[model samples]
Target: MENQNLNKILSGEKLSIDEEMVPGTIHLVDLEGTLNVKKESGSQSNIILQPQPSSNPNDPLRWPKRKKLAQFSLLWFWAFMQAVAVNWSGPIWTLWTETFDCTYMQLNISSAICFIFLGIGCVFLQPTAMKMGRRFVYLGCTIIAIVSNIIGSQGNSVQVLYVVNLLSGFAAAPVDSLVEISTTDVFYQHERASYLAWFILALYAGSDLGPVACGYIVETLSWRWCYYIQIIIFGVLLIVQLFYMEDTTFERIDRDDLEDKIIQQMKSRETILSAVQSGQLSQERVNSDEKLNAIVSVNNSINTDDDDESVDSSIPMRTYWQKMRLVETEYNDSRSWLTIFYRPFFLISFPAVIWGGVVYGSQMMWLSLLATTQSEIYSLPPYNFTTPQVGLTNFGALIGSLFGMAYGGPFVDWITIKLSKRNNGILEPEFRLWTMIVPTIFNAAGLLAYGLGAAYEAHWFVSAGIGQWLLGFAMSSSGAICLTYSVDSYPKLASEGLVLMLFIRNCIGCGFTFAIQPWLTRNGLKVTTWLMFMLSIIINGSFVVLIKWGKDFRRATKNNYYKYSDPMFGELFKK
Candidate 1:
């Protein structure tokens, strides 16, 4: 019966059990521990590596642990600095209004312009990254950051501030999209969530901690010093990246070719299982690493295309000079730059991607709320906190984000495996949604506590410590969950999906920043707080909808997914 099921799957039959399963629904868990496949070593021996590493020695997946870590750390730090440069102005906005002789609304518009460009930049830069190389985009953005900061440090007028923000937002755009894609390049699916959470933490740390540092800098020295210090740090970073950073972008077999190999391998594995069940071969032979490697080698030779001349064993590892090249021209994609730019807009049609956007965008709305209102609320009346004091309050959100990083990443990965085991080893993308309950509850309560606590003049801790902490937890965790869910549901389209999701998130954030002041002015803090609380429940609670029907949504899009996943999709589009 098990053999029959495997055969049916190989033949592309939609078995009853797989009616709602689609491209992303994977057989992830090895429940009985008898599966013959390549898997993670040590305690995670049963966990298979998704998109199993190619035999090519230079595959990022085949890189040494230390090498992968080095690449990740450099990218992570770049993302952190970009977030810091974009957000460092929030704490000093009051100082800026006085310094530039502008109104709070003018500063708010400047911030809004930053977000608009952030969204536009994601759409624009991603194509360049795809066409040139991620390394090219990363290096170019670093230069932009350095130049933007230099201008900012010397700026005397509001218009100069606008130019600074425009460049800063554009430079910061990759933090929202490409960093996540680069992460996926170096890590496998099982280990990705934790690092995705780390990416979120980097953003939060910079956005949260940058202002904390800005407060002290402005109070002691001057606002110009913030830009001056960033200029120095970015300069050092540019030099390090030029020598050390390796482009993760690599060309690999597409969806159909990978699926063919998987089908053939599964058939071979099933034959071995059948032999064991019939007492034709001993279990010890099945468990031997030598036996599995022999079988895998045979399968690879059988599956290799006739036209491909290069043997897997003959592929050489990349040299130090090759790795540090400014552009990965060897792996250049054949797709047109316009096609890459337009793909993300097309992905907005995917339900899971759209839902992921809403979930993540809601977090952005909350983040914008805190960013916009912190000074206004904390500086006046009950709190009457000084500049540095207001900046210090972000520490609560920072702490909350730390806990959120743990819960959203490794914890979710662990839970997904456990649940997959229970469901007969079939891992549905919807399994990722089950943990969304934690963030949903955290988000609603955090909004209420932060907003109502501030409205009623509660203790500083009530609003800052408890409320901001809860908000921070929900922001990071929920962002990770939804982003992971969308990517997992359409693994082939991960880059475009992320671009669309961030586009939506930044647009929402931009609009919220524009409206928050007016809304507060019209409704006062109490009403606005209640409305936002209700809004939080509606937005975050949406995980319930996805958890229940997400599989059906994936199933519905299967044909569309296959069509779009094609590497020649650009040519087809033109025709």
Candidate 2:
């Protein structure tokens, strides 16, 4: 904004950019004398990227280390609880069928219904969080969890359980749609991949971890104890949330406000310096020159520590108490979602969004199908594993997830930093896509192993257990990579894009859950898995196409995003 030519570009006026500038490249730093973002790396540059926090110490990006951890932990636990509601039931099907006098198919249909409503619920819940306040949604979702769990524990009829589960699914939706957005609201660009990965970790752990407990409870105590455990967890989280889950939703673009203040101060300093040099003001009349000179001397000497302290003393900060408020300012009229809910659907035309959704949703659908298949397999035939052992099978997934959590999240961060440096910090979204190959290979392997082993009546551990760990690793890694790519590339539309992905993924999940039984029974596990391997290969291999043409896709969208879309939405992305 301080540079005249760049200001022209930001103001909707075209200045012919240099030939070196590409469609996918971002101009990260604006400091004078700093190295330009270019196509090759050499010497290191001492500059931070833009869209950074204001000096107003209240900015969440500027928050202290401990506060960041605490805030992230709170959202993570809530997300965990939401996911638990969906998968905890995986272990209780036997109890449910016996207690409610229903068939497995009925429970399958109910699960499918829950999946559908999970997306449906997000359609409303997401926009509410976007428009109203995150605090309100967090509180409401917690209350819903408490109430739904209570109802689930008491419900004895199939219809009643279905209703309770549907409500539970609804309550879980915000954790999906809001957590990423909320995390982005607080964390910086460099930290986003790690934090977002943790969110995915929480989600996967919540779903995968619950069956372990559910199996033991249903076998020893009662199936109702699953709901009781959820209630206790939610009760603790609810109390913590009342005090800790500060509203992270605000126009962080308020850096424009902060920048404007800085510019005004700069002009005053220039004026004072000019007066001092020109002798318009005597030495007795002004002390501003001495302060300005001290700042200049420190900068010239490269005493970075003194420079930071001096700048910190000059910059304004928001108080600790003020940062805790639920809403910082009146809602911007432009943020109104009267038409913004449809924005993500429009973004579906982008290749990055499509490929990411494919990699993510396909794996998610595969996982969902296995929950039923794994349970049904071990319950019968040569294995006849006890409920506790059935729960233990999830340990395979948990182990894989732990590995993915450890590997995928940090790997993306490391590779991105390396790639960014290699590219002279001129990042393209495709840099993140390289690591996705790991997931692609394993996605196919997992499906094939699980399906064939089961079809041939191979050992349960060989078929279901080992294969789940591989599939779980693939699913977790792919989900983290794709989502991090989408957000890094087009942060303004990330929430909408993610919601669209969720909606599609869940729809696919519902379809797969509905078909898995018939598919397995008719085609046998070997053939069904063979088809899955082929599909996984096709879906994951397509990442090559994105890597090749992703920049073009991003270019196309940038050209049309503001020009063809609603100005209200368009303006939100203005540089």
Candidate 3:
């Protein structure tokens, strides 16, 4: 049976519930209620649990809802604080020019350095997190953030500022990549988009609203106080994490064959029950019972030792201190450090994943554009806005992002289910691509309004209010939708896929930041904005192509996916 299943997959067959596995493919919706896989146990019971939970009490998927939320809340707050540190310097760029006697270009270079380190950090830190466990990395990054902020508070030169951003960027790397993976660690597939939306919200809130508070701090206190406050907040966070943050890293054995057996047994049991109810019990019914027992026996024979231990009630659950331990070695991926470090690079061949990176990276381009120009544009002749006023402009993006979060998170999840039902109860990763249409339109329109309004010297609302709000919506929505799509497509590689996505995203951000001043000087606002608008459309509109051919891409890569998934297939180079 297993050999036949493998044959079907190699032959490019459409995926079915009982068929061989494809990395990005799964049976998500069951409208007829025929498949006997584990389902969500409520009104929405048709939703199948993707990467179904194991029988082990210690599995992160089986954790209590409140426990999951508590851990998520800590990571969420950590991301928010780290983002605030990365962005707080933006509002004070003008003040820093005088204090450090630096050029605006030099300050932009500092921002570019931060972006460089952010991408580099994802590549270097992910393997460590995969090995030492998520808790160890989170706590370690918090400590590094505290010390970096302390150094930043004492900065007296442009060079010192560069060093501070470098460290801060590395410390905050997990915010972009690891948070999503950690969120997936506990949440079911059906619940992920909504929570991942929350992660985006926390990220944007910090980048946008952090400037608001920083503007006020620079007005009343000094720029140094910005870092001082972060130092205090991070101190508190580290304490809370030490006591409460349990590691979510867990190793799960493949249970697909066992699940297939269970599904078959369920069908046979139903047949026997119906025969008995109709008073038609016969040799066939007895044979069905015998077949069920044989299926159970086959399943038991193949169960790994770890599976047997999971069902052993004699073993106690982990103790509180054990759960709170800073490092977890038991659940390590067992690959050499270099293997995990280089894995994301191999995913560059994955079409859907590369598209996801481009979609997400575009948001960072707009974000970098805003950061590079927000102070420069608003502080000029017509507006003559103060630092605090420049900071307040981000409020429009903040409000827009909140609306975007709702649409991208829960709304996307809801739409996916509806579309799956319409497709005869089979969910395709392409369903989420439909959400991109709204963002693509908004993104283009926002760039036009923002650039042209400034060129024509129209009302501030034309650019900052209407334009920024739209950009905020695009940034938030496109980010969540694309990320959810990539993970849904290749869940087995969620961690590695996200790392490459962020690496692409931050590299785009860095390159754009370095070029923003030169690009603006060379072309001026109107021409630059038009060019950007065209670029945004081209990159974001690729969703249409993906929607048309995404499944084919996943199909083409089945052999590659399986090869990389195997622990021993490439051990020669992995060592």
- TM-score for each candidate, following the candidate numbering: 0.90, 0.82, 0.89
Write model 3 residue lDDT over 160-216, tens digit each, in one string: 989999999999999999889889888888788899998998888888988899889
Query: Clashing residue pairs, candidate 2?
Result: none
Cα lDDT tens digits for candidate 1, 1-575: 66665445445563333233386788775554544444564534366667666666667776777888988988989999999998877777777778899977888788888999999999999888887889999999999999999999999989898899899999999999999998888787877788999999999889899989989998899889999999999999999999988888887854343434444555556655676688865677656756444443331232211112233768766788988888778776668788888888877679999998888988888888888888888888978888898898899899999999999999988888888888877778888888888888888888888888889999989888999999889898888888999999999999999999999999998998888888988999889988988898888888888788888888888898888888667553463
Better of 1 and 2 by lDDT: 1
The TM-score of candidate 3 is: 0.89
lDDT of each: 0.82, 0.69, 0.82
Root-mean-square deviation of candidate 1: 4.9
Per-residue lDDT for 364 in model 2? 69
- The root-mean-square deviation over C-alpha atoms between each candidate and the true structure, in angstroms, is 4.9, 7.3, 5.4
Q: Is candidate 2 or candidate 3 better by TM-score?
A: 3
Tell me the lDDT of candidate 1.
0.82
- Model 2 agreement with the true structure over 138-208: per-residue lDDT tens digits: 88889998999999889888888788868888888876667888888776555567888888888788878
Candidate 3: give its CA RMSD in angstroms: 5.4
Please give the lDDT score for candidate 2.
0.69
CA lDDT, candidate 1, residue 40? 61
